[model samples]
Target: MEGLHHDTIVDGEEDDSPAKKQDSPVEEELVGDVRIEDFSEKQINHSLAPEERVNLYEQMVRIRRFEERSLRSYQQGHIGGFLHLYIGQEAVAVGAVSVMGEDDHVITAYRDHGHALAVGMDMDECMAELYGKKTGCSKGKGGSMHFFAPDKNFWGGHGIVGGQTPLGLGIAYALKFNKKAGSCLCFMGDGATNQGPFYESLNLASLWNLPVVYVIENNGYSMGTAEARHSAGEPLARRGDMFDIDWSVSHGHDMYEVRHTINDALERAHNESRPSVLEIVTYRYRGHSVADPDQTYRSKEEIEEYKKSKDPINLYKEKLIAEGHLTEGSALEIDRLAKEEAEASAEFAQASPLPEPTELMDDIYWETDNPASKTSQGTMFFETP
Candidate 1:
């Protein structure tokens, strides 16, 4: 706690862009718009019921542990294929997923383990999927980048740069057309934000008033490219205004800010049937995809500074300890449990068998009204059930 106060603000934002339009104090006062309950400075949050607070903390811890274990396993050559870690971006997952229930949907790029865990997907199942085991979430057909639990409302882990954006919009459109109250959270990195799907998805989402939250995890780099060198406008939050959608930009490292942003976005969606884009300015502590070194893009000092100063888990722990909800022993116990869970997940994946080559013909498709829409896989030409 001695050094906690100095890290209060991770991002020192100064913008003279049109997005920084000043709000009149008198007008805001007349409408009670500045009420603390009504407006929050950031999306990461902590003002909630004890149960909810504990639950959010658990999710973030689970995400951190999951990433740590996965990265370790990848280094040891236990988990094969592309493994993108959402290490420092756990707050985005914990805060956003906390706002939704079973019926709502989620979609994101390859960095998906945290999103799955946040949405109540079993860690064991997720790990099994990563290991390409037959008992995996996608039945081992898809590994780290393509695990889809439709029954769990997880649309998928898309690999294409900005592929999931359109699919997410379609899902939200389907829900709306079907008279369901569910919305979709479409997540992508800052690198993917400039892709065609990003603009196309936003246009259709806002035009149709689809209930979709297009979240840009701005981690300052798209692979080895820095944001300043890669993006024309580093701020993604204000980009939504051009499409006539409401948005919030917040520090992705702060849970309080994330929670506040999610609540606000969902409120606008539920009340007015609108779309939103919540830009979370976050950073990933690891390399882009377990293949490249982040040193090519960022300095070691900056990384270490973020690691020491703005760790989401430590920040939340400090707050909880200050408020007396958490003790040092209890916090350590939580960490122990997270590590144990990861261990169990690894064991489960180890014991599970991989899918057979012939079975690739199966588990690829489901039935539809039109028989022609059925998909087949492998050289056997057997229709995937």
Candidate 2:
């Protein structure tokens, strides 16, 4: 999706137009008024023990600290290409993934560092990927946008807008085909909702009753364009209604709220093989990429206001402290440890080797990588001529 950061904002497109501007709803949702008290004590997260709740808080802090570390690395020229930080939207990935069952799978767009970590990926391998080292998750090839762990059921870190939606549909279809009670949680940004492929994926998902939950992490702005300017609909999730797919909206700042909303959608998928479109209203502090200037589109005050009230880590930390699940000292210690872990991962990445040129074509072919599994009888690569 880094390529999209450089896209020219065309004057008139199918989903975006001057005529559609009037139809777009107000931008009142960006403030994120939802608080911890909004949710009942014995709500969807009732089953979680005190330790488990504290762990969730710790997870959000880990994501924040890791992203902050990566940003620092990027500024210092240790990382290359576009770096999309998940600084403000930690709750959406961590909270949702927390509720995922063993059979549940996940895939997301290029803003994927948060999801990658939430799914139990090690910090060293992930940071190595960003540094383009041989020890990286994709062996230094995939970079920041293409972390994959099939063993963990985290399919990819796709770099295209809405490109993973169909793949997610296929995963859900396979689950249903194998008669397995599972769901594929496909995530995309607010901008991706306007993409044609996403709509097509929704159509097929609804038609076949595929167990895929489409999660739109609507962080108000799609790249530099705000939600009201990019999309025509009131809430992007309502588009799912046209396909007869179940849909709902939730505030992403609160971990408990995120878990509650996503848990329901996952249950729908698990029990009925149905699809859902969950629009989680979130926010992003940085620009589309680390290189992009945020001040060009939004105000500094707006960003500061969000950081003040809706920061997922701070919100969850205060909630846990209030509940007596954690103390201020413990929370600070957890954050301190997370910062150390991120720094250690960066050191490991710096020490890792670069991929050899000879190894370039090694992993390209399944048959080549596994000679014992080769059954083809033709040249796989072309000559220099």
Candidate 3:
């Protein structure tokens, strides 16, 4: 990794100081052009078993139907707060998570319902969380932006931009400290690529050789802003150039490509204790959140075109049918089952109870054994207002 000279401009004037020539080792190595690889036709074939193919299709359909129902529920005023639907980006989560081991950690940004479902989080609990019911995965406290399942190694859906970046590093460090074989997969949006923590976390992960996979789900928009408007270069994978980490771009619509890319990346992470940055080029069918009308920036025609050409569910279904791994009737049956499951989850959420008012203070602080406890020696005391 050789360093390259970058000219600094201030007030429309170029700075030519010799001291500026001393670029950081990371910066120096960031000079080369980034190449995004696409899997060959042969590579995608025979990668998954017949049952695995069916499972992938089912998972993608489940996520799609679940989000569609959630969108309807939100419109009906049954669900409150911001609802970020993961309508079109199902293939990314399902494919990447398909290759993960049982013990690997998964974290992501606010658009996390798909991720939670991909990692086997209960659909009833996820829907309940969105409904703010007590039976939710986060006990109805975290809401849509903070779904967590520690038992499944799903860290959370962080509300803040780029908040999970450093947290992922921390988890990776812990895995390394414990001599664990599993790695952490941290998913973020293209918008998060501009945040400071994204860079900071990557730097440390590279320097420490932490076992983490930093995935940027580039859906071409930072809210309503197009990627071209917000970013200097389109492919966010190059952002990894500054770090001593492997980086690549994968098509988010293709589950096979996503699974293969992530599987290879995890192999490197486990074998060499290295981190990787994967930029999965995907798109969101809905607005950034339910609040924004997505039409202000992009045309409806564009969305329809993407749906026609690159919809993940349709693409995978066609693949399965073509490969003789699934029948058209079976695919339709799977879709029906997914819709039924999602509807049942919504019903369960509706029937679930709300959290008690007194429960507001619960899980807010850690209880510690205080020596000065009045009750008894080694008694636990929790500080309160």
Query: Among these predicted structures, which one has the highest lDDT?
Result: 2
In order, candidate lDDTs are 0.75, 0.84, 0.80
| Tens-digit lDDT track of model 2 for 228-317 | 679885667778989989887666887877887788889999998999998777789898999999887788887887788778888888
How do the predictions measure up, each by TM-score?
Answer: 0.85, 0.90, 0.85
The global Cα lDDT (0 to 1) of model 2 is 0.84
lDDT tens digits, residue span 1-385, model 3:
0110011111112223221211112211111132222342424435666898899999999999999999988998989999998899999999988889855789999999999999999899999999999999988999999999888889999999999999999998999999998899999998999999999999999999999999988888889887767878535666787785778665677787688778777877898989998877778889999878977888887678678777889978877897798999999999999999999999999999999987776775433223244354452436443
lDDT of 1 by residue, 260-318 (tens): 66766666666666888877777788888987876666778777777776677777777
List the candidate 3 regions with Cα displacement exceeding 4 Å.
Answer: 1-47, 368-385
User: Quick one: best TM-score, which candidate?
Assistant: 2
- Candidate 1 — which residues are off by over 4 angstroms? 1-47, 367-385
